[model samples]
Target: MQIRDLPYADPGVPDVRSGTRFLLWLGRQQLGGQVKCLLWGLLHHLGIAGLPLGVGLAVQAVVDRDGGRLALAGVLLLALGAAIAAGDVMLHRTAVTNWITAAARVQQLLSRKTAELGSVLTRRVAAGEVVAVSTGDVERIGWFVEALSRFAAAAVTLVVICVGLVVYQPALGVVVAAGIPVLALAVLPLLPHAARRADVQREKAGKATELASDTVAGLRVLRGIGGEELFLGRYRAASQEVRRAAVHSARMWALIAAIQVVLPGLLLIAVVAYGTKLALDGRIEVGELVTVYSAVALTHHALRNFEEIAQAFSFSRPSAKRAARVLSLTRTTTTVPKPREVEAGGDLYDPLTGLRAPAGLFTAVVCGDPDVAGRLADRLGGHPTEPDADHTSVLLGGVPLDELPLEDARTVVLVQDKEPVLLSGTLRELLDVPTSGKVRAEHALAAAQCDDVLDALAQASVATGGDPMLTRITERGRSLSGGQRQRLALARSLFADPEVLVLDEPTSAVDAHTEAAVATWIAELRRTRTTVVLTSSPLVLDRAHCVVLVHEGQAVAVGSHRGLLATEPRYRAVVTRETDEELATADGRAVELDALEGESA
Candidate 1:
C-alpha cells in the first residue's frame, strides 16, 4: 500500500488477538510494499558487501599490473555505487509509505470504532488512553512494521557475508563468522531491562497526557471554582514523574547502545588482528586480508540493524497491545436474529422500569438519581449505555428495540444526551445533521427557544463582517455560554424530527423563564409525536401529558402532574420540594381554576 492509496479502500478487519499477531496482520495487509522494501534493502546491503570484494580485486589488479583488470574493477565499483544509491532512495520511499499506510489503517479502524460506540466509548476506555493509542501508539506500530523489511535484509546480508568470507579465506572466516552472532545476540540480555523501563516510561507518559487532556477539557470549570492552580500543580507533578521515567528508560537504552558499539568494535579488532597474523604468515594474500578486514567493518554496520529492530519491538509491543485491546471490544448484547426496522411514531416502553411513553404524547420521567434517569434514557433507545444483560427489553411498536438494526433504531428514537456535543462548525452546518427533514430549521430553533443563540451568533458574525451561516464556531462551542450551547444542541435535536425524541435534562442549564418557554414550545411542537423527557423540573413536568415518578430505579407512580402532586409523596418531594400543605393549596387553586373554566365554557 502506498501513501496515495491511503485510507485504504478497505482497511480490512484487524487481528485483535494479540500485539504480535496484530503486527503480523499489518505486515500481511501490505505484503506487496514489504516485498518492495525488502528487495531494495537487500540490494543496498549487498552493494555495501560487494565494496570489499571490489577493493580486493582492484588491489590484485594493481599488484599484477593488469590495466584491463583494473578498469573492470573500477566499472564494477561504479555499478555497485549506483545500485547502492538507487536502492537506498527507493528503500526509504517504500519504508515511509509502509509506515504511513499502517498508521492510517489503524487510525481508520479506531475512527470506525468510535463512531459505532458513540458516547459509550469514553465510559469503556480512558479518554487519554484513546488519544495515546490513536496518536503515538499507531506510529510505533507502523515503525516496527516498516523496520521488519530492513531487519530481514540485514539478516540475509550477514549470512551471505559470512559464507563469502569462509569461501575466500576459511581461517579469517571462522573468527569473523563466530563473532557476528555474538554481536547480534549480545543485546538480548539487556533487552528485558530496556523493555521494562520503556513500559514504565510509556505508562507515566500516558498518565501525564491524560491529566493534561482532562485539565484542558475542564479548564473553564476549574477557573470558575478557583481551582486552576490546584490542577496546574497536579499536572506539573505528573509532568515531572513522566520526565523521570523517560530519563530512566533512556539510561537503559543508552547502556544497550554502548554495548552495541563496544561489542562490534571488539569483533572488528579481533578480525583485523587475526587477519594481520595470517597475512604475516603468508597464509592469506594481502588482497584477501584487506577484503576480510573490510567485511568485518561492514558486518558491524549490519549488526546495528539488529539493535534497532530490538528497540523497535520493545516500544511497539505495548502500543500494539493497547490498540488490540480497543479493537477487541464488542457489543455485549447478542445479535438480534432477523433484525427489523421500528415503526414510526411507535410507543417507547421499558419493561425493566415499567415506564412507558405512549405514542404521540409527552411523558416526563422524574428520578431521584440523575444516573438512573440517564441509564433509562439510554435503555429507551436500542443501545444500553451499560454492558449488562439484566436490562429489560424496550419495545417500539411491539418490536424489541434491540432487534432493530442500529441505524433503523436510531432513526426511530433519537436520544438527546444531558451534555450533547456541538461540533465546531457554522450555525447552519451544526443544524444540518442527518434527519427526516420534516421540521424546518427556523421552526425547530423556535421550538428550542434559541433566539438568544441566533442573536449571539449574528452579533459575532456581524462583528467579523462575515455571513452568519459561515461564522466559525470554536471547538466544542467553548466560546458559547452553557445555556447557549444547551439551546443550540436542543435546536439541533429538534431539527432532526425523529419518530421518538428522548431528551435528558434538556433545559437544566437555562433559567426558569427560558426553561418554561422551552418546555411549552417543545410540548406544543411535539404534541403529535412520542417525547420522553427525563427531568424533574416542575415547568417541564407540568407540561407533560403524563408524569412517571421513578424511585429506587423503578417507576413507582404514573399520573397527571396535578394528580401526582395531590397523591404520591415521593413524587412531590422529588419534583416540588414543597410541603403537602403548599402542594394542597396549589392543587386546590388548580381545581378552582378548572371549575371556573368549566363554568365559563
Candidate 2:
C-alpha cells in the first residue's frame, strides 16, 4: 500500500479475542509488505555473508601471486557491495512502509470503534487506556510487526552463512559456525525476565496516565471544592511509581543488551584464536584463517537481529493486550436493526415506567432522582445506559424503536444528551449536521438565547473580520462559559429539528433569566412537534403544556404545572424541593410565573 492510501477505506473487523490474535490479524493484513521486506533482508544479509569468502580469495590469490585470481576476487567484492547497497535500501524502504501502514490501520480501527460506541466508550473503557493506545501503543505494535520479517531473514542468513563456512574450510569453518549459533542463542533466557519487567512498567504507566486524565478532567471541580492539591499529590505519586517501574524495566533490558554484546565478542575471539592455532599447525591455510575470522565477525550482525526481535516483542506484547482490551468493550444493544420507519406524531411510551407522553405535546417530566431522568432520556431514544437486557423498547407512535434501523430511529427521535459535546470547529460547522431543515440557524440561536455567545465569538475572531458564524470553537467548547456552552449545544440540537426531541435538563447550567427565556423559546419553536423535557425547574414546567411527575422510576401523576402544584402533593415536593413556598391557589401560582407564556398551538 502507498502512503496516499495509508488509511484503508475499511480496516475490516479485527479479531479482538486477544492481544496475540489482534497482532496476528495485523500481520496478516500486510502479508505482501512483509514478504517484500523478507526478500530484501535476505539479499542484504547474503551480500554481507559473502564478504569473508571474497576476502579469503584475495589473500590466497596474493599469497600465490596469481593476477587472474586477484582480478576475480576484486569482481566478487564489487558484486557483493552492490547487492548489500541495493538490498539495504529496499529493505529499509519496505520495513518503514510496513510500520506506517500497520500503525494507520490500527488507528483507523480504534477511530471507527470510538465513533460507533460514541460517549459510551469512555464509560466502558478507561479514558487513560484509550489515550495510551492511540498515542504510544500504535507505534509499539507497528514496530514489532515490522521487526518480524527482518528477524526471519536474519535467521535464514545465519543458516546459509554457517553451511557455506563449513563447506569452504571444514576444520576452522566448523568452529566458526558452531560459535555463531551459540552466541545467537545466549540472550534467549534473559528475555522472560525482561518481559515481566516490561509488563510491570506498562501497568504502572497506564495507571499514571489514567490518574493524570482524571485530574485534568476534574480540575475545575477540584478547584471549586478546594481539592486541587489533593488530586495533584495523588497524580504526582502515580507518576513517581511509573518512573520507578520504568527504571527497573530499563535495568533488565540493559542486562540483556550486555549479554548480546559480550556473548558475540567472546564467540568472535574464540573463532580467531582457534583459527590461528590451526593455521600455525598447517591444519588450515593463512588465507582460510582470515576468512574464518571475518565470517565469524559477520555473524555478530545476524545475532544482533535476534536480540532486537526479542526486545521488540517484549515491549509490544503488553501494548497489544491493552489495545485489545479497549477494543473488546461492547455496548449492550437494545435495538435489533430492522428496515422500518415510524410515522410522525406518536406518543412516547416507556413500558417499564408506565410513562406516556401524548403526541405533538410539549411535555415536562420531573423525576425526583436526576440519575433516573438521565437514563430515561436515553431509553426514549432507543439508547439504553443501563446494563439490564430486560428493557423493552420505548415505543414511538405504537412502533417499537428497536425494530427501526438506528439511523431511522435517531432521525425521528433526537436525544439532546445531558452533556452535549461541542467538537472543535467553526460555528457554522458545529451547526452543520443532518437536520430536517425546518428551523433556521438564526431562529435556533435566538430561541436558545445564544446571542451573547455569538457576540463574544465574533469579537474573538477579529482575524475573520468579525464573523461569528465562521468563528472556531474550542474542543468541548472549553473557551466558552458553562452556560454559553449549554446554550450553544441547545441551539445546535434545535437546528436539527427532529420529529420528536428529547432533552434532559438542557438549561440546568444557565441562570434563571436565560433558563426562562430558553424554556419559552424552545416551547414556541417546537410547537406541534413531539417534545419531552426532563426537568424539575419551575420555569420550564410553567411553559410545558403537559407535566408528568415521575417518582421512584414510575409516572405518578400527569397534568398542567399549576394543576400539579395545586392537587399533587408528591409533584409539588419534587418540583418545589429548592423553594418550598406554598401557593394557595391556581391564580396565585399563575401570577408567580406571569412572565412565562405557554406554547401557542
Error of 2 at 85 (Å): 1.7
Residues 1-601 of candidate 2: C-alpha lDDT, one tens digit per residue:
8667867988888888888899989999999999999999999999998998899999999999999999999999999999999999999999999999999999998987786556667767888999999989999999989998999999999999888888988887787677776778877888899899999989999888988887887677788999988988898898899899999989988887888788778877887888778888889888888887888778877777898888889888999998888777643356465557788888999887888988888999999888899888877877666656565778988988878765677688888877888999999999998999788999999999998998999899988999999999988888898889899999998999998999999999999999999999988999979899999999999999999998887898989999998878778878887334453464466765664544332
Q: What is the lDDT of residue 587 in candidate 1?
A: 78
- Number of the predicted model whose TM-score against the real structure is largest: 1
TM-score of each: 0.92, 0.89
In the range 231-257, model 1's lDDT, one tens digit per residue, is: 999999999998999899899889988
Model 2 bad stretches (over 4 Å): 222-228, 334-359, 389-413, 555-557, 566-569, 578-601
